[model samples]
Target chain A: QQQVKQSPQSLIVQKGGISIINCAYENTAFDYFPWYQQFPGKGPALLIAIRPDVSEKKEGRFTISFNKSAKQFSLHIMDSQPGDSATYFCAAITGNQFYFGTGTSLTVIP
Target chain B: SQTIHQWPATLVQPVGSPLSLECTVEGTSNPNLYWYRQAAGRGLQLLFYSVGIGQISSEVPQNLSASRPQDRQFILSSKKLLLSDSGFYLCAWSMLAGFYNEQFFGPGTRLTVL
Candidate 1:
């Protein structure tokens, strides 16, 4: 069974628009939540992370909104650009293992 | 700074052929190492992880196996290749202090079994 589930396996947005990717988890023990952005033929890179202690965390145009009670987290990309097109993965770490969602493919049309 | 290295960025093999892929980490000691496989249109699947030298935990059963002979070196091996093994392999490391709260990954190796 997949411990973490992500919605909207694919997304398309226009330039200067917003792109949202969401994920939900079943394990309450999970504390650290991180989102990774991966380009084709490259390794996934850390995008933004948020803990349950905070409801939201933002870096530049990227923001992570986490809801502890609902056990959901979402990534919002403001002013989406063509370069923002890539695959995004949301992961939850518990103990020494990490559970990652399937993934979301984002496309930003200029 | 810490960095991870994976060898033979790409590989092609035939059925029943032997396979070996190597991964190494720099600027850290006794790091928790992991091996993950990404299949087409699928999520990153954890294969094996090691917290110390000569120790490994397998998450899935397959023809693949892993070994950690040294603190910073990890190797994935297979006695015979299978067509289903074709995919992207990623190596990652995490500091034990954080207990896997954060991890870094290697560039990944693309394997094609024909």
Candidate 2:
């Protein structure tokens, strides 16, 4: 069974526009949510993460909005740039294991 | 700073050939280790994890197996590789169960079973 679900397998956004990716989880035990960005031929790098205690967390151009009741979270990228084109993955940690949602491929067109 | 290493950035092997992939971590001890595989255009799949030396927990039952002979070394092996085993492999390490601990991954290794 897929524990975490992500929407929009692929997305294209204009440069300087907002790029958003949403994800949902079924397990309420999850306490930590993290997003990872991976470029072609490169390992995934942690982007931004949010704990359930906070409703929102922002860092520079990246922000993570979380809803604990709905078990949903989203990543919003402000001023999207062409260099931001990459695959994004959202993962949740319950206990010691992490479960990842299906990835989203985002392309910021200049 | 902590770093992870995986050998043979890319490999192409014939079917039925034995395979071995190695991963090691530096600047840390008694870390929780993990092995993950990703297919083209797919999400990462957890394959194996080890919390300490000689302790391994497998997430999937496949032709592959994993071993941790030392505190910082993890190995993935297969007696006879299958064509479907082609994918990118990643190794990660995290501080043992604690608050706000995050995993750090290696450069990754790409293996193609021909």
User: Clash totals for all models, in order?
Assistant: 0, 0
Candidate 1 residue pairs in backbone clash: none
Of candidate 1 chain A, the 10-residue stretch with the lowest lDDT total is: A91-100
Candidate 1 per-residue lDDT over residues A1-110, each given as its tens digit: 99899989999999999999999998999988999998887878888888888999999999999999999999999999999999999999877768899999999999
For model 1, residues B25-48, the per-residue Cα lDDT tens digits are 999989999999998766798999
* Tens-digit per-residue lDDT, B1-114, candidate 2: 788999879999999999999999999889899999999988899999999999999999999999999999999999999999999999988884678666778888999999
lDDT of residue A100 for candidate 1:
91
Estimate the TM-score of every prediction.
0.97, 0.97
Candidate 1 C-alpha error for residue A2, in Å: 0.7
In candidate 1, which residue ranges exceed 4 Å CA deviation? none
lDDT of each: 0.92, 0.92
In model 1, state the lDDT of residue A41: 77
